[model samples]
Target: MIRPSSLIFAAALGALAGCATTSAPRSGAAVAPYRDSIDLAGRIAINYSRDGKRESLSGKFTWRQSKANTDVSLISPTGQTVAVINVTPSSATLKQSGKEARTAPDLDSLTTQTLGWTLPVSGLRDWLQGYATAVDGKRFVATPANDSVVTRDGWKLDYVSWQDDAAAVPQPKRIDVTRIALGQQVDEMAIRIVIDPVAQ
Candidate 1:
């Protein structure tokens, strides 16, 4: 699992956010919850930080019963592996190099802390429908719990292109994000997630 702390990423092209130092997984074990609130599955693009530069990668998460049961593989632009996390409801495991590391609930905190980022659960769900809510503390166009526009706490994220999707929620791909603190301009970080899936 990624050691949650700070992260340093050199994305395809963008500014970096946080930094972290970690060793590869030792054994292939079960991956536990990074948080108790969610389990997710979908094809996603993760954009993050390395050496203060933004980085991007694509992968899929398979989760069930509050446990992530999936084989996720991430490939760096250079064609090398950053890491692969295999998560299960009860336990977690990772395979790096030739060794595998298996652990329990530790995997959850470890991954997020190691990566120094928050996995995009809200984004992933909304991505399917093309709408998402921001974390309560994070800045955005609005809130979810008490926002006037929507019943949710996150921003009233909407996608209104010249065309619309047959699906009810617009795909996050086309939707633009405006930080509440900021002006009309969309947020670079949020937009980055919209175009590409990444941890917040």
Candidate 2:
């Protein structure tokens, strides 16, 4: 069964574009590390299945991230605030309307325990910016010709579009992420993120 927290967190945090195929490693320039701080407003869509029932959710989101912490707000199509999530290096918190806030020592554990899935916040922070840290500890950068990367933590990321095709290092406009089910208990999940052109 899909939990409400799963749907909420999926919309709050943030990709799948093409066939869930792995990308061959190719020569490319390294992408610069993500900035220390950013305020991004965008939309997110998620699709997953459980108990043989398929479900989907789409919502708007705003992400305010800094080196020390991050804040995310999930909004409904009618502009109502669905949930608020705050994350720090040591802890994470999630609050839904009229309910007690849920807290955990960290995001990975938090989502896994409460939402029944791994949100992979750490890896996602980089994937959202068109880069990834592979299991080997090497960084992979996204380029027009070579835009797909399989992350170290088990997610496949496809850089579907770029902010500026001509820029030396293009920012990701749309990122599609997919994770195949690890076991019968885990469902395959796909999330699509469309970042707005201008940062708020």
- Top candidate, metric lDDT: 2
TM-score of 2: 0.81
lDDT of 2 by residue, 1-200 (tens): 33484444443372111111123333656454556577888888877765677777888888877777778888877788887888876878777777778787777666766657665435666666666766465667787777876666677778899888787777789988777345122454678889998733
Instruction: Give per-residue CA lDDT, model 1, range 67-185, as digits (tens).
Output: 23434444444455544555554544544544445344534344454344533222332222222233443312211222222213333344433122333322233333333332242
TM-score of each: 0.37, 0.81
Q: Which portions of model 2 miss their true places by more than 4 Å?
A: 1-33, 181-187
Error of 1 at 147 (Å): 16
- Give the range of the ten consecutive residues with the poorest summed lDDT in model 2: 14-23
